[model samples]
Target: MTSLPMSDYYFRQFEHDGADAPAGRKGRIFSAICQGDAPTRKKLATDMALRPATVSDLVMELIHDGLITESRPAQSLQKGRPEILLTPAPGRLCAVIFHFVSHTMHCAVVDLAGTILFETTEQVQADKIDKQGFIDVLSSLAGKCTAHIPGSAKQCGYALSLPGIVDEPGKRWVYSAYWPKLSDFDLSEVSETLGHDVIVRKNLNCELRARTSRRKSLGTGKTLLIHWGIGIGAAFISNDRELVLTEGFGEIGHCVLDPLSTVSCKCGMIGCMEAEAGLWALATMSQDQSIPINEQKFEDYLQDCTDKSFLKRPLLLMAHTLRNLTLTLMPDEIVLTGPFVQCPETFQRLTERFELIFPEGALVRKGRKPKIVSGRRSKSDELVGAAFDLFRTEIGALCRI
Candidate 1:
C-alpha cells in the first residue's frame, strides 16, 4: 500500500466518475498486464507505444508496490537470456464481491487478476430476511471473505452486485420486484459497518460487462444480452467495444404490453412485460397451484406440465418483444440468460417462435438477421466481472502506488 490506502482510493473513485483514459504511464502498463494484452516488458512497450526504458521503470515501480511479479519462462527457442513475463500478484489488491440472486447471496474474495481466492453461498427465505438481516449477513460474509485475503494483499473494498434498480451515485438499492421488503434501503452507511467502502451496482450490468469481453468471438458488431429472470432486462455492447446505456437503458420488463390487463407488475405497473413473462410473475402463477418458486424446480415444472398452452402467452409476449427489439437494434447476436432461456425446451420454443415472427424475409433482410443463443451465468463470471470492473475503472489509483 502507498501513503494512502488503496481502500480509500477506491472509495473516492467509486464516488466520482474519473477520466476514461487509463491513468499515467504506470497505470497504462498495469492495465495492459491486467488485460493480458502484454506479458513481457518488450510487449508492453510495443503495445503502449512507450520506450523500453520507460516501460522498465514503470514495471519496476509496479513490482516494488507488490501489484505485479516478474518470472522467467522455462523454455526459450532462440534467446541468449530468458524472457521475463509480467503477471498480477495473486495476493495483492483484492476485492470482496457479493452477488445477490433470487433468494440467495453468493460471496467471493477475488484478486486483481480475476481469480477467486474463496467463495460461499447462503440461502434465505424471502419472507424471513429484512433489511437488517440482509446487512448482518453481508457484513458477516465480508468479514469471512476478508479473513481469506493473504496478509500482503490490500483489500480494496466491497462490491454489491444486486438485482433491480440501483441508485449507484447514492449507493442505495432503490427497488427490486422480487425483494420488495428491502426496497428503498440505504447503503451509504454500509461502508462504516464493514470498515470499507461498498459500491452498489445492478447485477445485469456486471454480468454484461464480463460477457462483453467475448465480443471478438461473438462478433465485432452489436451484441445484446437479454436476461429473462425474476426481472426481464437487457444489456448491449456496440461494435466499438463500448457498453451502451450504462443504467436503465434496456429495461424491457417495465414496458407496458397491455393497458387494460389486470396482471400487476411489481414495479407498480399493470400489464408490463415482466408481469406476464418474468420468472417472478410465473412464480406467482405456480404458487397458485401450490408449487414452490425455485428456478430449477420451476424449470422442472415447465418441462413436466401437461397443458403446454400455459406457456404460450408468456412465450409469445417475449418473442414479440424480442422480435421488435431485434428489428430496432439490428444486433449481430442476442444472448439470452436466466431460467426461461436456460431450460432447453422453453428456450427452443421461444427462439422458434421468434424465428417464426421475424424470419429472414423481405422485411428483415438476410444479413441483418441476428443469431439468438442461450447464455449461462456462472458465479465465477459475476465475481470476476465485479472485481475487474473495479480495477479497470479505478486503475489509476492502483498504479499510483
Candidate 2:
C-alpha cells in the first residue's frame, strides 16, 4: 500500500472544537514549536498570527502540562534579559513504534524530539503466525517497550507498521507476501488489547515520511519514492505537502505488466510488476549462476557481479515503470530506495536506463524535470517517522497531559 494506513481513531484525534478554541490553539502552538517554526513565545504569536497574550496563555498551559519546557539562552550579548527559548520537554510524552524488518518485529520507544529511548527486536516467522498469534507477539513487544517508559512520562500513543495492502480506515491487514497466513486480519481490536490508541501504517509510507521530514527541500514539491526489493511498493507526497493517504494508494507492485505472462506474484496474480523485477525474482534467477547471492550483503553482491547482463531486463522494466509513474505524477523529485538502490553500480545503471526513456531536454518543461536520487531505508527512520507523525497529528490529545 502506498498510504501509511493510519487507524480510524488516529484521524479522529485531529478533530478539534474549532481553530479559535483553546484546544485548537494549543495544538497549533505545540505543532509550531515541534516544527521549530516558533521557538519563543513572541515567535509563536508572530508565526501563528495570534496575540502575544494568547500565545502566552496556551504556552503556559503546555508547560504546566509538561508538554513543553522553557529555558534561557546560554549566551546573549546585547540583551538585559536573555530570551526564554521553548522546546518540547524530553521524556514527557513518548510514542511506541513497532515495525517489521524481514521476519523480526522491532519495537522502539521514541520521545517527541525523535529520540529512541529504548529499542528491542524479536524474530517472528511471519508464515507461521496466525492473526491472534501475531497480536500476541505484538502485545508482548509493546508491553516490553511501554514498561520502560520513564516514570515521569505518559504514553502518547503507539504506531504499528505493517507490510502489505491494508484497509487503513477499517484497520485491517488485507495481505502481505511475507505473511501469507495473515490475511484480512482485523486490527480494530489491537488498540483495545494494547490499552492505547494504535496507529497502523504501511512500512514504505513511514520510510518516505521520514525522508521528507529529514530533507526540508523535499517537502516543497511532489516527491515519489519507489522501493524495489523483496516486495516492491511506492509512496508519494504531493506538491501540496500532503501524503496521499487514500487506501491502497501505492500498490504498484501488483500492477500487471503483462496479462499473458505466466510469471506469478505473491499476491496470487500473474505478470505483476514484482513478478518481473522484484528482488525475489532476481534472487530466483541468480540461483543457477556463479554469482554469489548473499541477502545480508546484497549490495556487495550486486557490485561484485562481473556479468550484469542478467540485470538488463529487470532494470529496463523498472525504468519503464518509473517513466510511466513520473509522467503521471510529474514529481519534482524521484527517490529510489531498498536494496537495489544501495549498490552504486546498480543505481547508476538504473538511472542511466531511466534517463534513456526520457531523452535529454524531452522532459524539460518550464525548465523543470524530475531529479532522481538514491535514498537510504533504515529501521531507525521508520520508527522516528511513525513517532513524529503521531506527535504532529495527535498533538491536541497529547497536550492534554
Candidate 3:
C-alpha cells in the first residue's frame, strides 16, 4: 500500500458534524457491541484493543444511555464469575434504507446492529410518473417505515440510494437517464416532508459506502466500484477516502467508445458503453425483453448471450474502460458488481483483462498492481452498507441527541 499523508478520517462517508464528539468512546463501544454476537466487557476491551477498565467505564456509559443492556450471566461450570453478555437494546437505533432499482424502490428498515426490521418495495412506471410523484412515494415509504419501528426506536435518518447523477454537495438528483423527468429534482424536498436528514448518493456509491470496512485497513479506503444494472456506472473512493460520485461521475455510461457506431444510448449518446454493454443495450441489441436482467440470471444467461458471441464488443468496451481507469486513477481496489459482472465468465474475463493490462502500470512503479475484483456482497447486502453509512455518521456524532 502506498503511504499517503492522509488523515485518520480517510473516508468522506465517515465525516460528520461534531455534535457527538463527546461520545466518541461510547459510540465506538456501542458500535463494537453491534458487530459480533453479544460481547462481554472483557471481550469488548479485547476487540477494541482498550484497557479492561476503559471498557468497563464505557460499558456503564452505554448502559446508562439505554444503548446497551447487560444480560444475566450463564451458569459457568468451571469459572468463578460468569461473563456478563452485553447486547444492544432491541430497536434502539434504526434507519430506513431506500434502495432505488430500475422502476422499483426496495425500502428496508435496519437497526444499528444491521438487522432488517422490515422490508417493502414500491414500483412505478417510469414513463408515467413525474419527479414529484417519485418524491411523494419516497416520503410515503419513509412514513410507513418509520411507523413500523417501535416508538422507542431512535429513527436516526434515511439513506436513499438512487440511480443517476448524484450532486451530493448540492444534494439533488441532477439528471436521470431512467427517469428523464426527474432531472434537477431537489432531494431536500423529501427530507423536508419526511422530517429526516436524508443521505442521498449514487446507488453504486452507496454500495461502495455500504461495503467499506468498519475496521480501517490499508486498502479499504481506496476503492472503485463499477456496477452494471439497467445501466453502467462507476463509484470511486480516493486513497484519502473521499468518495468520487459527483462532478461528471454520471457520464461514465455516456462515454463514447465507438465514435462511428450506429447504436445510441438511453442518455442520447451514440456508441456509449451503456449503448453497447448495459442491460438496456443487451435488450436492445438482442431484441429480447424476456431476458432477466439481474445477477442471478447473468451466470446461465451469459452462456446463452455469448452463444452468438453477442458479448464480445460490450466486454471489450468494458475492458477498455477499466484499463483507462486503472492507468489513470490507480485506486487501491476496483470492485465489479451488478448483473453483468456477476457472470462467472464475464467476471473471469474482466479479471484476466485487468491482470493483463494492470501490469503495464509497472513501468511507472516497479510492480504496483491495484486489486481488481468482484464485489463480496450481493444486492441484498447493499442495504447493509446503506444502513452502515448512517450508522457510521451517527457513531461519529459521539451520540447525537
Candidate 4:
C-alpha cells in the first residue's frame, strides 16, 4: 500500500478542523464548509486548533447576522450528545440584477439561493439614453421592486450586465457603441439611485460565462459558451477552473469574417461576425429578402418557416461562425445561449451542422466530446448570476466586520 504524504494528511486534517473555528482562524474553515458537509463545533475547533468556547462564539455571531442557520440536531440512538448542522439562510438576503441589452433591459429581484422573486423588462432605444438618464430609469425600477421587501431597509446591491467592454475592477464602462455616453460614467450612481449599499458591474458575456460554468445541468468540467444576440462573442473556462477574462476579450464579432460581405457593423467594421451571424444581421437579411418580420413577429414565424432558402442561408452562416469559434477555443462543450435560443429549430439546425462538421476528435483528447446545447435558463441565468454576485460581495463585507 502506498502511504500518503505527511503534508497532505496534515492539510486534510487541518481543513476538517477549521470549519467551526474562531474569526482569527485561517479561511480554511469557510472553504471546507462551502465544499463539504457541515461540521460540529467540536470538530471545527479541533481542526482549527482553537478553544470550543471561541468556536461557539463565532458560530453564534454568524447565525445572528443571518449568514447561516443552525438546523435540528441529527438523530442519534446513543446516549451521547447530538450534532447540529449549519446552512446558509437565503431568504434573509436579496440582490438585484439588471441585464442591459441593445434594445431592452431585463431586471429581476433574486434571493441568495438563486430564486427569482420578481422580474420586469422594458424596451427602449438604449443608444438614445445618456448616462444619467439610464441610471435614473434603473434606479426607479429597483426602488419599486425593493419596496416590496419588508424590513429596516434590507442590504441591497446591483449587478449590471452589459454587452460592451467594461473595466471590471474600476466599475467603469470603457466603451459600448450601444450606449456611447455611458462610457466613463460612475456606475455606482445606479446604486445610489436604488439606495443600495453595494454595486457591481461586469461585462455581460463574462458574467454569463461565470454563471453557465457553475450550472450542474451544463455538466461542470471546463466548458465554453458562445452568445449570439445583438453581438457574437465567446467565453471560456480553463481545465484548472480559471475564468480567463482578457482585456476586450471575445470581440470576435468585430473580426472581419468576410471583407467582401457587404453588411456593415455598428463597430464601423464591414463583413464582421457582428455584421453576419448577429441578430441584427439575421433581422436585416430577413427584411432585405422581403420577409415580413419584426422582433415580436419573427419569434412567431421562425417556428413555422418552410422556405429552405431563407433558413439555409442564416443557418449556414451561423454554422460557419460556430466552426470558427470551435477551432479557436476547442472547448469541452459549446453551449449556444441567448435570445436566439428562443427559436428551437434554429438552435437544432445549428447543432446538427456543428456535429456534422467535426464528427469526432473535437475535445476528444480533453476527455469528452464537445457537445452543443441551448441555454436552459435564458433570463434566469443572468438574474441568478447577478444575485450571486451581490451575495458574494455582502459575504465579504460581513467577514471584514
State each model's C-alpha RMSD to the native: 5.5, 5.1, 5.8, 6.8
Candidate order by decreasing TM-score: 2, 1, 3, 4
* Top lDDT prediction, candidate number: 2
Give per-model TM-scores: 0.84, 0.84, 0.78, 0.75
lDDT of 3 by residue, 181-214 (tens): 8878787767778888888766766566555543
TM-score, structure 1 vs. true:
0.84
> Candidate 3 — number of clashing residue pairs?
3
lDDT agreement with native, every candidate:
0.73, 0.74, 0.68, 0.60
**lDDT tens digits by residue: candidate 1, 99-150:** 9767888789887656788988788865567899988889888878888888
Can you give the lDDT of residue 261 in candidate 2? 68
Query: Which regions of candidate 2 fall more than 4 Å away from where they truly are?
Result: 1-23, 31-53, 72-85, 289-295, 361-368, 398-401
Question: The CA-based lDDT of model 4 is what?
Answer: 0.60
Q: How do the residues 1-401 of candidate 4 rate in per-residue lDDT, one tens digit apiece? A: 11111112112333433344444243344333444466667787777677878668777776777656677565766576677776545566777677865467777777655566777777777768887677767876677767665472244577776666566566667666567667666675555566665445445444554455455453446566666665667666653433555456667667765668888776666787777766666767765464332334555555566653555655676777677766777676777765556688678877887677656665643433567777643555566545554555555555432
lDDT for each residue of candidate 2 in 199-287, tens digit (9 for 90 to 100): 87887777776666555454358888888877678888773445555487888888865678678887877888888887767677565
**Model 1, residue 172: displacement in angstroms?**
2.6
Worst 10 residues of 4 by lDDT: 1-10
TM-score of 3: 0.78
Name the weakest run of 10 consecutive residues (lDDT summed) in model 3. Answer: 1-10
Which is better, 2 or 4, measured by TM-score?
2
